[model samples]
Target: MLGIKNWINLNSSSVFFKGTRIATDAYGKDLLVSLYRKYINGYPKFFKMDPLSRLGFVACELLFNSEKVETLQTDNLNEDSCLILFNKSASLANDKIYNETIDNENYFPSPSVFVYTLPNIVTGEIAIKNKIYGETSFYVIDELDATTIFNVVSSSMSDTNNNRCICGWLECSNEDNFNAILLMIDKTSDTLFNIENLRNILNYK
Candidate 1:
């Protein structure tokens, strides 16, 4: 059975971990950057990432760094420990900005903006930061589908060689609304991996 070893939920106004609110922003203004400075200390690269990447990066950092779970020895992670992420908007939030640069003669198309036009880039950012040389997949669904996510994680965990799985919903609308709930699952726990359980945990906030 796979169980949630650590989890983080970050929306516009607040950040939660393991059902506990760690920080709250009343105005939701610059909350991500505030959280990053307060908790992450420093990572200059974070400033250059698109909104989606910044959201995923901060959430993953908090989860893996949580004292509740055993510290992840990222260097020794198994190659099969995978990342499965789903989003409703894909990369439309950044795509729009990149698209604007295409036709404006004064502003040449930016390679930096072009690189984040794909949602999978967020997964790649996490993988590279953690040294996770494992399988990574990103899916865009019409809505938050817990059953599909459960099936994917179940299938990945079934592999004898695969041990850890990071699966969740990460969405950044064109309006800049951000919502992310990332969970780290592993076979070492007795908690059952099911749709209802996942929904309960994710909706806990």
Candidate 2:
């Protein structure tokens, strides 16, 4: 069998993404307060679920956008495209918190809280929303670095089955703070964006 196609570097072409809902507004103001002023009952989605779920929701919203959908479904790569995700915070934080509610000796493990115990569930949710059947994986590490991110992304694309790839770094802590960065990549681009620059672009460094 032929060797897997070399992975395309992220900076070689333009990447598209949608939705980046941070705790602060675009103007660097409090987002929750801003939502309250514009609504009568206040925004419930942000406060109702764990911060990780909220981040996953935003990721789903981005991947499910009309433009992204068109690109994902219509565009064809050389069979070296895949999906890679890097995450720092594990789902255990939320699980740990929710387990406290029932672990007080009276209740058993609550299914509601037990569901978010797996970090990869977030990636699975995004795939379901976008209908993406490509290679999917989630990496949990202590920190996000250029080498680690580049290696995993390269490995995913190194497979002959992948023609293009979408790679990202996602992090969410129980403190209601979360951030995600996504990149869409393919071969055949004249431009080149190095890993270091890509990391800088995503503020990962």
Candidate 3:
């Protein structure tokens, strides 16, 4: 996904685990729980939903703060903006559950489990909420390569008219290990950059 510009990592274990040591270190646990509770509190079984739902909630919360976005507009999906999501773990939790259903012992399919089997769904959810409809896609790479990431983003932004993209890399190996980076870029500017310069800039992080 070559259209994001920020990183918001969350701890699923902290929210999922009830009263455990791992939950204690969640950097933004209370905030997450509070938001979720506020949005879907009345839905008795809302907490039973997937992690993507919670992530969507957080994304919406961040988007609500116009100060954080590069460009803010109304609820129009066909706008000149687009949202793309990239991740290594393509819904491993759903996959694991789906595999259990299809195993020789069970051998049954559950659409609920299959719905989140794609990593792109996370981006889709965000786009749906934000109404970004320029272009969207999901990529599964073995590792995060800055060059590759830059190339993909550069290619997508080649068309100046539709250069605004929200690119994101969200990796969630499990409930405890997850990372998300989002970047928003405008490709109309005639800016110049070199690999060495980028390397030097990124090395500081």
The CA lDDT of each predicted structure is 0.81, 0.54, 0.53
Question: Using Cα atoms with residue i matched to residue i, what is each candidate's TM-score against the true structure?
Answer: 0.91, 0.67, 0.67
Estimate, for each residue in 117-148, the C-alpha lDDT of model 2 and write its tens digit: 78877666555545567777888888878678
Per-residue lDDT of model 3, residues 25-105, tens digit only: 334434455655643354333344355544644544443442355364555524777665666677885577678889888
For 1-205, candidate 1 gives per-residue lDDT tens digits of 7877777888888888878887555424388788788778667988889999988888888887785434355456548677889989999999998988887575789899999999999999988877787778899989887887788778877878778888899899853488999988887766666788898876776
Which window of 10 residues has the lowest lDDT sum in candidate 3?
14-23
Model 1 ranges with Cα > 4 A deviation: 26-29, 68-71, 104-107
For model 3, the superposed segments whose C-alpha errors exceed 4 Å read: 1-49, 56-71, 75-78, 187-205
Minimum summed lDDT over a 10-residue window in model 2 is located at 4-13
Show the colliding residue pairs in model 1: none
Clashes of 3: 13
Among all windows of ten consecutive residues in candidate 1, which has the lowest summed lDDT?
67-76
- Cand. 1 Cα-lDDT: 0.81
